[model samples]
Target chain A: MQTKIQELRKERKITQSELADAVNVTRQTIISLENGRYNASLILAHKIAQFFGVTIEDIFIFNEEEENL
Target chain B: MRGLFCGTTARNNEEYRKVVKRRMLTMTILIIVGIATAVTAYMAFHHSTSAISDHTLGIYSGVGFGMAASGLFFLIRDFLLLRNEAKLKQQRLEQTDERLAQIRDLALKPALFTMLFILFTSCLIGSIFYPVLIYILLITVWAFLIVYIIATRYYSRKM
Candidate 1:
């Protein structure tokens, strides 16, 4: 899964730390999500989406091939 | 609203503080018990009339000292967490982080298997020289397996 978290955060002039604080997660988690190294749980995804004032699909791009792998 | 989010975070922080305070109390109790045990072990070791063996006294002393040290370590950590607001917030975030929790869960199985392998090898080596040591190691291995089995069953039902 890839996420537009970095782009969205940048567009909103939000730092990773700020986003992490808003979502109640470590900065490392935001970094990992932006880097596509980690997939956020549903709860975290919801939090992030709410923080960004967007839908989950607007930020996270889920690929069927990735799921198959 | 931002106010609602802040309220929730404040509530969570309060909950974490309560949890830490409870742990500190438990640690205090542990320290007292440890000190009492150590004193008893010391008196038993020094008194000729005591019925307990020296080896048992030594074990008690070690356990008591270990418990005290562990308790002190955690107590100090909790104290620091309570004193430092930034550190407390960071620790709380890290503790509640889903990604870190997942990583911990993923690491646990491999760590357990590695520990079990080390214990099994020790048991095999000790069997050649110290039968009692081998039995103790075997018992530890069995206990670990039993715990794993029981935990699996519990989580399977709960989850």
Candidate 2:
């Protein structure tokens, strides 16, 4: 799973720490999400989406093929 | 400060404060118990009237001192968390972070298996020297399995 969190954050002029604080997570979690090293849980994804004022699909790009593998 | 990002709400702060208070209380109890145990052990050893051996009393003292030290360490940590809101919020975030939770869960199984393996190997080696050690280690292993089974059953029903 890939996320547009970095791009969205940059567009909104928000730092990773700010986004993480808004989402009630550590800054490391946001960093990991942007680096594609970690996949956010549904609750976290919802929180992030709400923080960004966008739908989950708008930020998270889920690849069916990659998921199948 | 009203809308500032503290990673916790009023309800969370209240709950965290309660948790810290509970932990502090437990630590205080542990410290009291530890000191009492250590003092009793010392008195028993010095009096030489108790049926318990000197070696056993020494072990009890050591365990008591260890418990007291650990209790003090955690008590201080909880005290700091209680005193500082920013540190409390950061600690809460670290504790509740999904990624860290996942990593901890992932690491738990391997760590438990490794510990069991080490204990089993030590038991095997110790069996050659002392028969009682084998029973102790075997009992410890059985206790672990029993606890694990109980926890699995509990979560299975709850979840």
In order, candidate lDDTs are 0.84, 0.84
Candidate 2, residue B48: lDDT: 59
Chain B: TM-scores of all predictions? 0.75, 0.82
Error of 2 at B81 (Å): 2.2
Residue lDDT tens for model 1, B50-131: 5688789889998999999999998998998998888878777877777777777777778778987888888888888988
TM-score for the B chain of model 1: 0.75
Off by over 4 Å in 1: B1-11, B48-63
Pairs that collide in candidate 1 are none
lDDT of 2: 0.84
lDDT of 2 by residue, B34-137 (tens): 99898888887787565578788889999899989989998998898898999988877776677877777777778789988888898899889988889989
Show model 2 residue runs off by greater than 4 Å: B1-11, B48-55
lDDT of 2 by residue, A1-69 (tens): 899999999999999999988888889999999999999999889989999899999999999998995
Best candidate according to DockQ: 1
